[model samples]
Target: MQLTAIGINHDTAPVALRERVAFQFEQIKPALALFKEAWSGKRSLSAPEAAILSTCNRTELYCATEAQSSREQAVSWLSQYHGIRTEELAPHVYALPQSEAVRHAFRVASGLDSMVLGETQIVGQMKDAVRTASEAGALGTYLNQLFQRTFAVAKEVRSTTEIGAQSVSMAAAAVRLAQRIFDKIANQRVLFIGAGEMIELCATHFAAQHPRELVVANRTAERGMRLAERFNGRAIPLSELPSRMHEFDIIVSCTASTLPIIGLGAVERAVKARRHRPIFMVDLAVPRDIEPEAGQLEDVFLYTVDDLGAIVREGNASRQAAVAQAEAIIETRVQNFMQWLDARSIVPVIRHMHTQADMLRRAEVERAQKMLARGDDPAAVLEALSQSLTNKLIHPPTYALTSAPANERYLLKEIVGRWYSPR
Candidate 1:
């Protein structure tokens, strides 16, 4: 069980680079299969067990490998697959092995590692990633145990600590950002692009203000309408955004689109129509829904996921206590998980001991049976059998102890006691 977590996160890489490293939802399973196939039966590498967790804030690949050097090879595979140069990707990547990997995993799942500290959405994303890995035949014994324990640790951290208390959610941060530009949210026309979970969260937060007009633009009109109807708003086809872009004072977009949905040209025309009225935009999608260049417009206050990180960090002094408590809990659990991994490492040794003992027992029993068949005293044969089994069990250890150097005798004696002592 040589476990390693390799990849970049919000702490190590900027959003621009993180997006390049990210795995889209539809690409993960096949990419994982390809990852294993790339190194399958290679001289220096074995088939690896892998799972990827990719979100707006981070992209991480957790893997189990055999060779220590193979970890580096895994990193190379990731870089090559994403078309990133090794030197380009190397500085931002982190490769944590065994105990470090265990600690990293526990921290990540518990929300201690999120850009928005103690955010719960990552838990769901991680579960979805693991489920995909399982369906793709990439998860095996080691990764399976790691994630199961990871989930349990996350649940415990959330329940036992106030780590999530006073948390600034991304949606709340968006509203806060909006308030900075507009005096009253109720006075603004808000448009949300895409009808996903993130969009739902932002819409819910903004709806509390009873905005003047709320509209959801989505590719699927029915689903968009269903979501819009909940907030007493309306839905529009995504294609209409180009012509209607000027109608809204604020736009927040998060979709699975591989390219920018809100282009610079659309925003420029919208700005001209508004006579440069300030428009606050949040591009929450990974590849980015809004063009990065659009942020240069005078009326546009464009905030990417990275920008919200600063807004979310404003009141962290209060969470220091809860963060400390969660760290303590995670440390203890990390040690326990490492202990389990250590025990697994010696399983073959334990199996060997059991096999040898079984062979000796069978040989002694066969001798006793032969004696009984020859009309020898049954009690005598049984007594001899018992003595022989005991002697055979202790013989190897006794010989080793006698032959061992004087300096090694103490350690050998201790091992003997451990081996023969009752559980």
Candidate 2:
């Protein structure tokens, strides 16, 4: 079987495009089933295993199939489902096969490929995606084994390296950036526009400063209220954002909406209402909840995912020793995994050889029984049996040595001799 990964990530595409393709956890099962059905029809391939990983930074499909056609079919299905132009999406996507795919998965699970280097959240996200795919009937033996190993590798990387220790999270970086703009975080009014994990993290950081006021606006008021209550803040319906936007000095938004929730015009009005007071805004959503044009306003400061990357890089020097150790571990683990894969590829050949040997052994045993029944000498029967077993064991290799090409014969001799020679 061939293993492949096709997807776009923060490095390849902007949040605008990434958000358009992101799938929520609840939507994954049905999506995977549909993807598998479409792939099987187009490629004429049997049931292919598939799993999708979608985060704010990436949307990827990892698959195991019998042929290359299955990989192409999966790519086409993803492009069609997201309504993204194939030409535009193709360049950003990386399609890895076999060993390369295995390496990519290991690196990703270890957080080497994350936007925030060494972020631990991605491992849980990967696990969730795997669970969802299994429930959707998309995971088969190959993908199941691949993902299980991925988790183990992630655990090893974290335990051996300080990759996670010195890294500043995006949420914490957002607060740090806001502090640079304002004299003190306690003097700013912070507003969070979603009730998701990212928003919760941002709220926690900002609340530590005891901001003047904290508010949460969400599509679901009940969810918003629960999150806001934890910080001793207030919650507002998304619909109320237009009128209430002027009250906050700092805005951090990360919502699952396909379209921008806060636009240029709304920000313009908010600035006018506040008499042109400076506002710090961070758009953490993949397809940003805040409008891109808002970054152009004179009194508005807007930072996207790319902008926060530098701030998160602080203190890397302290972690270099740990990173070196982690990389060495990953390299050794990768070699071992590849060895397993190589052995797996030859299983059918090994089985066939064992079957042939078993057939020859049974025939010789039957002959010996007949000789004993006929009252032949026991010593003669034993000698014949030993000679027959030796010949049968050597027949295939001996025949090949005579008939094979010179290079192949030389290679086979070396292999067979080494395998059978005394230690």
Candidate 3:
């Protein structure tokens, strides 16, 4: 079977497009099942293995199949699911086959390919995707081994290098940007627009400043309340955002909503209510929780995930040495993984050889049993069994040698000579 990965990410596509294709955690299991069914049915393939990794920055499909046609089928399925034209999505999609696919998976799981280098969250996200696929019965031996090694490489990367040290996280960068707008973070009120992990992290960083007030707004009141309680803040339903948005000076939002949660009109109303006070906003969502027009407003300072890329580049000099060391470790591991894959590719041939040998041995044992049961002398039966076994072992080689063409015989001699030569 061949391994393949096809998808788009932050580098290849805009947040708008990425969000359109993003698969929520709840949707993953069903999506994987559908993908497997589609590919299997279209290509006459059965039990094709597949896993999907969807995050704010990327959506990817990793699959193992016997034919290239399966890859094309998977691409069409992804385009159809997202309701986008195949050609439109094709440009942004990357297809890696065999060893390249294996390398890509390892790099991604190791955080070498993350939006924020060395970010640890992608590792967990990858594992969750694998678990979902396995439970759905879409994972097979090849994929299982591939993912297991990917996780192992990630762990080794984390333990052997300081790649994560001195790294500026999106949450920390959001706080830093807010401080630039407001003289004292402790004096400002902070509002988090979602209860997801990104929002929780942003809240943690901003809460360290002991902000005057902290509030969490979420579609689910229970989830909002849970996150709010952690920061000694209050929870508000998302419906109340428009009316109560002006109360906070800082807004950090990262939601899975398809549309912009905070539009230009909402921000305009909020700015007017705040008496034109500057509102610091960071949108970590792919589709963008805040509208682009909101950034054009006079008193609103808006920053998207792309905007924070520059800020997160700080203090990287100190980690350069660590990155080099980590890369070396990855390179060695990648080579070993390739060797394992090579061995896996020949497993069917190995199984066939063992089966053939078992058949020959069974046939010889049956003949020896019949001779002993016929009342022949035990010594004669043993001699006959030994002769039969020897003939069975040498017959094929002897026939091949005697019937071979001149060139074939020469090639056979060369092969046997090399086999018997000293290492």
Candidate 4:
């Protein structure tokens, strides 16, 4: 079987495309089931082992299959599932096989492949995706082993290297950019949407700046209150945003909602209510919590996840050496994984060999039992059985060695020698 990684990421596609291709957290289970059903039907066998890793920056499908051409099939399935044309989607897709796939998985887990270099959030996101896949019954030995090693390599890299130092996360970048706009975060009123990890991080950073007032709005009031209380902020229902948005100078949103929650009309109304005061906004969601049109407003400084790329790159120069170390470690791990894959390939051959030997032994034992039943001498029967078993065990190699061509005989000799006395 071959290991394949097929997908597109922030490097290859714009957020406009990335958001369109992204699978919502709730959509993953059913999508995986559909993929498996289609894959098994197309291949005329059970579905190949598969897992999907989708985030704001990337969407990837990893598979282990005997059919090398499954890459194309996967792309087709993705396009069909998302209702996009294959031609439009194929341009940004990358299909990595074997060692390249292994390398990519390791790099991703290590945060070498994130928009924010060495960001630790991707690790949790990957684990969550894997858990969903496992619940969906999409994982098998190959993908399970691949992810386990990917996690181990990530842990080693983080502990032994400085890849995460001086790293500016999206949340930190948002705070920095807001500082540029507001001069003093202590004077600003901050509003956070959703209670996810991103929102929590952003809240922590902004709270440290001593914002005058902080508020968290979420679909679930209980969850929102929990996160809000952590930073000494108040909680509000998402439905109240239209009325309450004008009160905050800084708005940060990251949610799993498939559609935009903050629209042009709502932001326009909020800007009007605030007497055209500047409102700095950061949207960390993939499909986007804020509308694109909101960015066009003069008083609304709306920045999407893609807009933070430049800010996140600010301190990356210092991480070059650490990236090199991480790469070296990843390369070694990739080679080890490939070696394991190679060993797995010969398992069927080993099984066949054992089966043949067992059959030969059973046949010899039955013949000796017949001889004993016919009143043959027990000592002679035992000796003949032992000699016959030994001869049968060595017959194939013995015959091939004696009948081999002169040039091939030396190669056979080495193999036969190893069989009797392994190195």
Candidate 5:
């Protein structure tokens, strides 16, 4: 079996394409189950170990399966699941094998692969994906080990390197953009959609600026209220958004909704209510909380996750030294993981060798016992048992060495030498 990481991310595909492939938080468990089933069917093997990490920036399937399953099979499964054509996905997909997959996982968890360099939220996101896959029984020895080691590598990188220091997070970037639209965030009323981690994060940043009013709107009022109270803000049900939209000067949204929530008409109505006052909006959700057309309105400043790329990249220049340090750490960890994977590859062969040796020992012992029971000398029986065991154990290699073709003898000799060599 081999380890593989297959998917498209912000680096490989545009936000529109990434959104098409993005798996919602609730969809992860079912998607993993479906992937395993489809993978086993395609490869004609047992279901492979699998885990998915889906976030605003990427959707990746990390799997361990036999060589019979090609990387193309994985891509086919993803495209099929998301209802896209293989050809369409082929251009954007990056299929990494073994060590590259391990390296990708390490880089991602360590925040080296984030849109906002060295942002630590991806570690938690990865953990959540692993947990979901495990709960779905999609994880096996390989994936479990991969995630465990990945988390360890991320921790080590964060501790030993300055990768996260002064890093500009997505939340911070959103606030930075809001600042560009509004001279003083403190004077603007801010509304956040969804009470998830991203909302919580953005709320914290915005609250630091002491927005005139901070409100959280969510499907579940209780969760929204809980999140809002953390920043001494108020909560409103999502149903109130359209009616109350005009009240907020800035809107930052991140939700798991599979479709756009804030549409063009709704924003137009809100704009009219506000007497055409400019409202800055950030759609951090993969599918996007606000409709793309809403950005066309004269009084609306709309920015999606992709729009923040330039601002996020600004932090990269200062983080070069830390990035180099993190890369060094990731490289060392990748080598260690590859060594472990290599050892795992030989385990079955080692097991078969032990099984064969045990079988030979058992057969010789049985013969020796019968010989002794039939009144044969104990020493003769013991000698015969030793000869039988030694001959049987070396039979395959010895026969190969003697019967090997002239052209193969040198290679056979090397094999025999290694087999009998002292450690």
Candidate 6:
């Protein structure tokens, strides 16, 4: 089976479409179970081994299968699962087969493919996806090894290069975007929806400005409270979003909810209450917590994850040296991984050759032992054993060279000659 990576990302699709196929971190395992059931018995794909890497920027399925059409099948499955039309999704999806898949995996893990070049967050996200895949029993030898080497390459890239150090993270970009509108963050009230890692990071960055107020609203009240406490802020229930959203000047939201949490009406009302005051908003979630239409409102300066890409890429030119070094490391690792895969593909033939050779050696040894027991000369018996072993080992190739078809004889002879040639 070949390795294949199939999916759409920020580069290929809009946030509206990417979100349609995006899976929440917690939703992966169960989704994999559904995947297994869907592909349980098939002609092109059987017992499909796949690991999904779903993040704010991308949703890719890394699969081990011989199916030449696995990419199309994956697209079909994604559309069906998400209730999206195939024609709409087909154009944006990219399929990387074999070496390309390996290269893509390595690049993604190393953060070379991220909007924020060389950011470290993708490493953790990939590890989590891999762990979840393993837990879901979606992993097999091929995928397991692919990710192992992928992680090793990622580590090498991060350790050997300064790309990661130079990255302006999403949280940092969000802060910078907010600063574009608000002259002083310290005077603005900030509202953060969702207490996930992204939210925590954004809150921390904004807190440094000593914002007048920092509030966290999450599905779980306690979780929100805990995250809020870390920044000396307060927590509110998700239900309070509509009523209290107008109170804050800057709102950053990222949640796992499948639907929009902050709708157009909510933002419209919040804008009305603020009396035409500008409100900076950032939606980091893949599916997004805030509605896209909400961004059209008069007082709302809303940005989605994609909208922050330009800000995060501010100093990429300065990090070109690190980027080049990281790319070199990734290229070497990709070649090594492909070589491992090539070696892996012939493992069954190697196993059979060893098994057959062992059986022949054991049989010859048994015959020689019987001769020795019959009071034969020890020197003669030893000579016979060595001779028998050599002959038996050479027999298969000798027979093949002689018995090969007329057109194939020359090639077979070359193979046999190479096999028996001097070192």
Candidate 3 lDDT by residue in tens digits, 1-423: 888989999789887788888887788889988887777777677858899999887899999887763446666788899898988787888888887888888889877777678899999989999998988888998899999999999899999888897678889998889889999999999999989989998999999999999999999999999999999999999999999999999999999887898889999999999999999999999778899889999989999887886787674667778878877887888789889878987999889978877788888789888888888898988887788777887676678777999989988778767755899
- Decoy 2 TM-score against native: 0.88
lDDT for model 3 comes to: 0.87
TM-score of 6: 0.90
Model 2 C-alpha lDDT per residue in residues 1-423, reported as the tens digit of each score? 788988889888877778778887677888988888877777677978999999888999999887773445566677898787877677777888887888889889988888788889899999999998988889997899899999999999998677898688899899889988998989889999999999999999999999999999999999999999999999999999999999999999999887899989999999999999999999998767888999999999999987887787664557778767777777788788878877887998999999999999999999999999999999999999999999989988889888999879889889889979999
Clashes of each: 0, 0, 0, 0, 0, 0
lDDT of 4 by residue, 1-423 (tens): 889999999999999899999999889999999998898897787787888889999999988877774667888999999999999999999999999999999999999999899999999989998899999999998999999999999999999999999899998899999999999999999999999988999999999999999999999999999999998889999999999999999999999999999999999999999999999999999998899999999889999888998899887988999999999999999999999999998999999989999999999999999999999999999999999999998898899999999999999999888888945
Relative to the unseen true structure, what is the C-alpha lDDT of residue 327 in candidate 2, on a scale of 0 to 100? 72
lDDT of the candidates, in the order given: 0.91, 0.87, 0.87, 0.93, 0.90, 0.89
Model 5, 333-393: lDDT tens digits are: 8999889988998999999999989888888888898999999999999898998788787
Q: Distance from true position, residue 94, model 4, in Å?
A: 1.0
lDDT by residue for model 6 (62-159), tens: 88875664677778889898899999999999999999999999999888899989878888999899999999999999999999999999988888
Q: Where does model 4 exceed 4 Å of error?
A: 399-409, 421-423
* lDDT by residue for model 1 (1-423), tens: 678898898899998888888889999998998888886657546688999889988888888877663657777888899999988988998889888998998999888898888989989999999999999999999999999999999999999999998899899999999999999999999999999999999999999999999999999999999999999999999999999989999899999887888899999999999998998999999978888999998989999999998989886768998999999999999899988988898998999999999999999999999999999999999999999999999898999999999999999999898988999
* TM, every model: 0.94, 0.88, 0.91, 0.96, 0.95, 0.90
Better of 3 and 5 by TM-score: 5
Candidates sorted by TM-score, best first: 4, 5, 1, 3, 6, 2
Error of 5 at 349 (Å): 1.4
**Candidate 5: how large is its RMSD?**
1.8
Alpha-carbon error at 162 in model 2, in Å? Answer: 1.4
